[model samples]
Target: MPRDADATKERILAAATAEFATHGYAGGRVERIASQAKSNVRMIYAYYGGKSSLFDATVAEALRRMAENVPPRPDDLAEWAGDVFDHHQRFPDVLRLSMWAQLERPEATAEPSEAYRDKTLAVATADASPLSPVDVLVFVYAIAQAWQLSPAGLTGLEEATDESETVAARRRSVVIAVERMLQKGP
Candidate 1:
């Protein structure tokens, strides 16, 4: 039986994704990623060059997954916001990976890629508003991820009381906020 190079690469990426999510770029160890993937560190180095390159590939894959799974819905921004929230809730690893990239390698963060641009452009409403559709989407995304990324300011007290309730309340707030913003008509 022959080993599949693509399958091995996919396994490596999946392992690296989990490692990076758990430890960030500075803290994550390629050895651990290789061990977990049941592959060798040399294979990772050969396939990805090094930790930094691996991180970049992981980030790119995460962004691609997000763009594919949570595309914009201009006809119903509120629904889109909900969908984003759901996606984040389900895939917190993506957010964690992104946070690591932003915090550890701020300069590396670049403008939105075309994968995101087309979707954002489609969501742009035709109105003379100060905020662009992308801006609105960013705000809505922030709202949806408030609890996940950082909630000390958003619901520190409520979170202390009941974590589940706090999360539910925040998710509701995200939907309502996006709905109101969309209803404001551009």
Candidate 2:
């Protein structure tokens, strides 16, 4: 792509990401994203094809950022969990957007979702653990996402707070529960 064109596409995606994160897929509007991007609706369509495509880009970018923040490492589950929670805390709106997309159009991106999931599972399998590969993945992601999704009341933190003591306490509980389950192996 040409320099200006590439820059425009990046800006459009950045705008769409923030917009969707704030409003979710149902509430995200191309018009609003375009306005925020300093581009027109036509430009968004021209660059990204359409709203669904833009959503895909937004998710991909979010995931990429996530991967950057916390690449999988077997011995670092605690740190990894912290990174995941921090990412969600810093970008809670993105998580909300993802939940809406997951609910609304799961089939639309099942392939990528499964691929991403499998890769994560592979990371868990690298651990010299007692849990089955599937169980490990399920437990790890379950804990991380649950912690990310925990309400402020459950966490006893400001809704916008990130990785508070309460939140970390919740995570520790998850980790202890999973460790016990692994030790007891089904």
Q: Choose the strongest candidate by TM-score.
A: 1
Tens-digit lDDT string for candidate 2 (1-186): 445987888889888878887777778899999998888999888877899888877777766666666565556554555556666767776677677668765544453465566556765667636666665655666676786676858755545555456666666766565555555445
lDDT of each: 0.79, 0.69
Which residues of candidate 1, in runs, are more than 4 Å off?
107-112, 125-130, 152-156, 159-168
TM-score of 2: 0.76
Each candidate's number of clashing pairs is: 0, 0
**Span of ten consecutive residues with least summed lDDT in model 2:** 106-115
Superposed by TM-score, candidate 2 places the C-alpha of residue 76 at a distance from the truth, in angstroms, of 3.1
